[model samples]
Target: MRLQKFMAKAGIASRRKSEKIILDGRVTINNTMIKELGFKVDPKKDIIKVDNKKIFLEKEKIYIILNKPVGYITSVSDQFNRKTVIDLVSKVDQRIYPVGRLDYDTSGLLLLTNDGDLTYKMTHPSHEVNKTYIAEVKGIPNNEELKQFKEGLKIEDYITSPADINIIKKDKGKSTVKITIHEGKNRQVRKMCEKINHPVIKLKRVSFGDIRLNDLREGDYRFLTDKEIRYIKDEINEK
Candidate 1:
């Protein structure tokens, strides 16, 4: 198998991230530094090491659901000295990384796992995993604005897919709207509201695909239930 694939199977990181580890000269095969992108190695025979630590495939997989809090980055590490989701999951001995991204200011349901194939399937745009968010906007959207959101809005380079939006509450200057969309574009919910002239003041993800946040508190994480894991696996396989 390819070196990156081997690392991915070992649950160190995704194949893409493993490539970076190799490129950075952190990985070696049989005590020899190997930085080539497509290099292959047999896990049964060849010894692989990353940063001088032997790499072995994990016998068991771990999946976690975290109610991420704001001010924490979704990445494994941040160059800007900010805290990341990995920091919040330090209690977990097994390696894991966030399945997708949530902007630093956004909070709520986030998935983490050591299963690389599952991570790829979940994050891949082609899978179209639905994500739901509750957004508090600066102003109540008019009928025309709401229509535009349902029809889809253009944000710079890409035209967003049609979203399912419903007004949960409306007051003098602000309104709470629930939106469900499959595209995970950067700051997508906020950008959509901006396109409709109802800029988001606060945004929180309520659900991802079939997983709901429920009563999960911020900064807390729990292992996924067997049913939840099976459901996710089935959903990906169906796709």
Candidate 2:
């Protein structure tokens, strides 16, 4: 099998991240550093080490949901002196990483897991897992602007896919809007509102796929219920 896929199957990291490790020259096969992207090895026959530590695929999987707060990055490590999601999930015994990214300034529901295949399935754009967010904007959005968002808007080089937008509450100057989209592009929600001239002031992701944050507080996390896990697994399988 491909080296990256092997590492992902072992639960060390996602396939993309495993490729990064290989490119960084941290991964070695039989004591020889291998930096090639296309390198392959049999999990049963080859000795793999990442950063000089013996690596093995995990036999058990863990999934978790976190109510991520602002000021934390979605990365496993950061070089810019910023806090990462992993720091807040120290209570989890096994090492895990965020399934997808949430910007440093954005807060809300985020999923973390050691299950690479599930991570790939959920984060991959083809699965179209819906993510719901409540965004508080600086000014109220007009019908035309809302319609534009629902129909889709051009932001920079590409036009966004049609998104679900509902006016939850409209006040004197500002409004609370619920927006749902399946794409996980960088700063997507913020950019979408920017396209409608209603830049977001506060954004909170309330749901991802079938999971909801409910009353989970910032920095708090919980394990996925057996039924929830099974439902997600089945959903992925069906796709």
Candidate 3:
């Protein structure tokens, strides 16, 4: 297999990230530094090392759902040594990467897995899987603002795709609203709310596609049920 694909399969990183790793000459095969994206290696015979540490393809695929809390970044490791989602699942034996991202301040359902194919499929914009988030914003959106939000609001360069939002509660100066969108742009929910003149005070993802956070408490994680795994794989297969 291609070097980047092999690295991704080894749970080192995503394919795109693996390519950058290769280009940066951080990967080696049999003691020889390889910077070629198309370099091939036999998984069974080739000794692959990333950052000088040998890596092997994980035989057991692990899928975990984490109720990521605020202050934890969604990454394997942070350059600044800040805590990461991986730190919450330190007991997990296999190396896994997060499927998508939630901003540093956003808390909620986040999937971590070694299944590279599923990760790529889920994160790809073409798939357009719905992600539902509950956000507390500055103020209640007026009818016109709500209409603009649903119709698609221009934020920065691109207009957001049509989204669904419903008022869940009305507080004294803030409103709790549920927003669902298929796109996973960086802080998209916050940006969308801000565009409607109701910047988010707090955000928490409730669900992604069919996977719900349920009653999972913050900072806790659980392995995905077999049925949940099969359902997601079947959904990706269908497309």
Candidate 4:
């Protein structure tokens, strides 16, 4: 297989990212640094190394869901040494990575896995997987604001796609709302609330597609059930 594909299969990263790793001159085969994207190797006989560490194709694919708590970044490592989702799953022996990402201040269901193909499909914009977030905003939005939110809002340079927004509760100066979005743009939910003049006080993702966060406690994680795995694969396949 191609070098990048091999690296992705070894649970190093997604195929696109593996290409960058190769171009960055971080990969080597049999002690020879390789920068070619099309470089192929026989997994059984060739010795592959990324950043000087030998890597082999992972035989077991592990999938996990974490009830991510606030203050933890969704990454394998932190340059500033802050907590990351990987720290929460230190006991898991296999090399796994977050499927996508969640902001440091945002909390809730986060998927981590070594299944590179699934990760690639789920993160791709073409899949358009729906993700639901429960957000607490500074104020209750008026009917017009709600309408604009559902229809789409101009934020920065690009306009957001149509989303589903519902008022879950309104008390005092704050309101709890449910927002479901198909695109996973950075800080999209927070920016959308801000555009409506109701900045988010807190945000938590409750579900992605049909996989609900349910009653999972904060900072805890569990392996995905077989049915859940099947559902995810089927969801992507259908798209």
**Global lDDT of each candidate:** 0.90, 0.89, 0.91, 0.94
State the lDDT of candidate 3 residue by residue for 1-239, as single tens digits.
98888888888887888899999999999999999988989998999999999998878899999999999989999999999999999999889999989999999999999977678788877887889999999988989999999999898999999999999999999999999999988889999998989999999998988999999999999999998898789878777
Residue-by-residue lDDT tens digits, candidate 4, 46-154 = 9999999999889999999999999999998899999999999999999999999999999999999998888888998899989999999998999999999999999
Sorted on lDDT, best first, the list reads: 4, 3, 1, 2
Against the correct fold, how does model 3 do in TM-score? Answer: 0.97
| Segments in model 1 whose C-alpha atoms lie over 4 Å from true places | none
Model 4 spans > 4 angstroms off: none
Model 3 regions lying over 4 Å from their true place: none
lDDT of 1 by residue, 44-162 (tens): 99999999999898888999999988899999878998999999999998888889889999999999998987887788778988899999998888888988999999899999998
Candidate order (TM-score): 4, 3, 2, 1
TM-score of each prediction: 0.94, 0.96, 0.97, 0.97
Instruction: Give the Å shift of residue 126 in candidate 1.
Output: 1.1
RMSD of each: 1.5, 1.3, 1.0, 1.0
